[model samples]
Target chain A: MDIKAYIDSGILELYVAGALSEKENKEVYDLMLQHPEILQEVLEIESAVIKLTSAAAQPSKTNIFSQIKEKLKFGNKEVKVVSIERTKYNWMTYTGWAAALVVGAGLLWTINQNNQLESAVTTAEIEKAYLEQQIEEAKTNLAATQNLLNVLRDREIISVPLAGQGNFATTYAKVYWDKKTNSIYLDAQGLPEAPEGKVYQVWSLTLDPLTPTSLGTIDDFNTDDNKIFAITNANESQAFGITLEPEGGSESPTMEQLYTLGVVASAP
Target chain B: MQLDTLVSQFQKKDEKAFEALYNMYSASMQGVIYNIVRDQDIAEEVMQDVFIKAWNNSASYAPEKGRFFTWILNIARNAAIDKTRSKAFKNSRKNLDAEYFVDILQTSESLEDTTDAIGIKKFVSKLAKKCIKVIELLYFKGFTQKEASEALDMPIGTIKTRNRNCIKELRTIVLE
Candidate 1:
């Protein structure tokens, strides 16, 4: 068998690539020991393959030896005596990785913490608006009560205590008449809750003539927390009366449905 | 160290010999693994595992069965293919298109000035598409001549002779 023909047969290339069967490998191994040229040919093909494959690798800064050594725990003692050139390479690659990780982790944590704090601030703002509404309501109530006290203290004001009358005699009311402002503050706290579709209408009356004039109805009587209603009364009234009327105020006072009546004492 | 001495020492669990072999074939193993997995980090991870496995199973290697380079190349290819089968790797890569090893060689940024790099770039740039597939299957992917022949739709003899002609063209360019 000519060795050159065997070399040219391309069987050795497949042999180096390990693309042959086990038996074929053994044959090639025998042939290589017998012939140096075949052996040299195999070496050359293997070398070319090694270079071709290695060139396809991506560029990497990682020192694979150091990584393997770290995993195997074999290089730490020998790490000291490692060449200065390798030490420099390890320094650049390993420390670079460590620093990047630390910075990245710190940024992520801070962003999460900031988001939590922002939500807390939003909740606080909503609570603050609610509290401010309550404070405004309290201030308005305090000012209103102070004005009522001042009107009652006036000597010129006429105080009328309207007593319950007729079949609806359980309800009573007080009327404070300030002749100067022509406004009467009716304290209807003693009045019972009006039935649905019914309202309490006030009437300013002249007692001698038996003439009744409608003032107006209290539409929000049931829902108002402070039942003191302020109605404008410009008439030089002899008496103040309240009676139940349907929905809107009546054209004339419903005398039989009268709830309360009061004669003004010394009308100024 | 000689090829026989180096492999014999490696088989005997000589740490220095193992290190020497790693330095010799690390980049080639990485390239082959990267070609299959198509990810640099995963390729490096698989490359490390292949070497560790080679160390652990050194007793199983027989010279009559194959060359030392061929033996490790088989390990690297097997390990990389196994990684691709894993759920983690499959989920991370939804669409793994078939890419030639020449695609990696064309990335000039990673190209070093070594004779291997220059010769490989020249050989691959000039390499026929059919030749690329043949070498990829037989050498890089460790497909048998029959499997390669069936895959490329050629006869068994044609796969051998064509591979011979391709490597012959490669040696003349690289050996210079």
Candidate 2:
């Protein structure tokens, strides 16, 4: 290669422009390394280009390198992993998670409280209903007792005392016959509870022929709160008796099961 | 430190080497950026951005590709040209019709204050009109031999030889 011809060819000037292809750039780089003259010429062309380009600039008042260093975080690279901004951001993240957990726990507590309150309200409503039912039952009992007192005190009513029979001597009862109402109020308070499949049958009796007329069986004897029962008796009765019979009561009194007998005091 | 050693250290992310490189080339980059954008503030902004980019992409640079100065000069020209095409830059700067980089030498009062600018001012004044256009296209604008040949309406050989003579003249005024 003619070194002077290569130098005079103006390729070195174009090399400074960075306008060459990659192959041409590699060729120029290799040539500059092998030859000292080529290297010197390239350096001169590059220096002149630098001066010419620098002439176009208006010399700025402030150096922008510091601003660039700040942008690139150049000097701060070693300390970047432990940067205060990163620490602050991590703290905020942890605080956010903690806040979320607190809020979640608060929500769970509120929900639990709400559920407990709802159940308490339900229990209170059930208790209120039970109390109200008890009040209603007491009122009904008071009214029934007051009406029974008025019936017993009436002057037109005839009272009879029934004595318990042989096997049930301790069991006693009373009958108040209200002729005006044609009804008898039987107070069987002293009577024992009727056995299953057997009911106490009341009968209106006459002593002339000892005839017994069946009234009716006491079906609700076990369930009645007060043992007082009102029964219609339109027959002209001189006496009354009670006997434990079958569930529906018999046409005639069962003599073996007679529990009580009473004679009307004002009877003819 | 030697330029090659400093550049090598810069590529390895040495902050001191980066600063050395920045101080050496920032002025030239600003000049090339100013010529394309024709505004000092925008030129400075683009110049800073160019250096920051060079730092970030330092690993991509190789001596086999080109000189470090040439590499950064290419980045500055492209960044400045991109700035001119931006909507904000176009709206702010209605007229950026400078024909050559040397035009700043004649018209700019901004350079009058700096004593360091005197030598370059003399060089630009003594530079021929043809040299100004050729250098502006080749070095400042990063135009290829074919592009510059088409732009100057001359043959590729003439552009190369003319650029050589122009750089030779520049060496006499500035480098010699």
Candidate 3:
């Protein structure tokens, strides 16, 4: 075969540009493998064309390879088992798998950590709500105590302690009477919790006649937090007493159920 | 690495070989596609898709049918043409007037990155007006001998020989 004639024929140039038919391409492919010179000519032509075309290309963006690798699901620093058939043990493969496993474990740990943190936040929220409720209760108690302190500081108000009497000697009670408001604050804290189906009754009495005025019944004795009751007392009272009654108070105090009695001091 | 070996490895999904092949022809492919697409950003996008498609369909490539460069070039041209025809693309580019690749090289200032930039710029300057049209159609546009002959209104023999001589002059200026 005349290699020189084939070289000068310009078919090699057309072949590389793919301007030839299939049969012509096959003929060229066969000639390339058979003739070293023919192959060399094709290479030279291809190389020149590559440069010429490259001259026309825009400068590519950075890291195009890594981007392509990422899209192909190939990790940057991890080994991907691209094919199961190839069993060659290489350092890169082991390192890649190890890195992948490490990343997987790291992800799992992060997720577990996040879950624990979320639960902790929820627990803190519940505890905060409980604490807020306790604070509110404290504020109410302080306000009630402050009001009681103000009543005790008033000079016109009279305090009468009704000590336990008769069979209920262990029980005692106190009343702060403010004649201006016709009201009395009964400090029933000294008394025990009222039993079921029973209420505490407050009474005002005149010393000479020993006549009693039915003030009112302490129906909410058990539910009161501080066990303090406020009663209205309009009568000129020389003494005060407390007695245990049924769900509803009787028209008069029950004598056997009488818990405490106290006399008012003479006016200064 | 030898072109044959590199191509065979690329067909077998060797990443390194694929990179080597990309480095070799991507610029040239970009040039060709840019000539058709007429937009730098779209041309680059089309080039990437062309390479990715080549990698995905590597098995379909047969040396007996064509050169690897030719195969990828064909893909790039078709993809760019397809992009141009897309409704979205057509809406943006309502008037994609006819302009040769030389117009790009002449207008572009980015030729400094290429090693043969000076030579190509010089060759393009001194290149005949007829030679420019021949290379544009026969090579950059992937026109066949017969298609080129019909398009250029020249004989098939004249198209081939004329393309051959144009390439010959290009080889002298760029290769030397």
Best by TM-score: 1
The full ranking of all candidates by TM-score, starting with the best, is 1, 3, 2
Where does candidate 2 chain B have its weakest 10-residue lDDT segment? B110-119
RMSD of 1: 18.5
Model 3 lDDT per residue over A8-62, tens place: 7878888888888899999999998899999888877887777777777766543
Residue-pair clashes per prediction, in order, are 0, 0, 2
Q: Among these predicted structures, which one has the highest DockQ?
A: 2
- For model 2 the local lDDT of residue A54 reads 71
lDDT of 1 by residue, B93-134 (tens): 967657778888887567767776777787888889989999
- The segments of candidate 3 whose C-alpha lies over 4 angstroms from its true place after superposition are A61-63, A76-268, B113-115
Cα deviation in Å at residue A32, candidate 3? 1.9
- Every candidate's fraction of true contacts kept comes to 0.72, 0.83, 0.60
TM-score for candidate 2, please give it. Answer: 0.55
Give every collision pair in model 1. Answer: none
Model 1 preserves the real interface contacts to a fraction of 0.72
User: How well does candidate 3 match the true structure in TM-score terms?
Assistant: 0.55
Query: What value does DockQ give for candidate 1?
Result: 0.47
User: A113-223 in candidate 1: lDDT tens per residue?
Assistant: 899999999999998999898898888888898988998898878889999997767878999998899999999999999999999999999988888888899999999
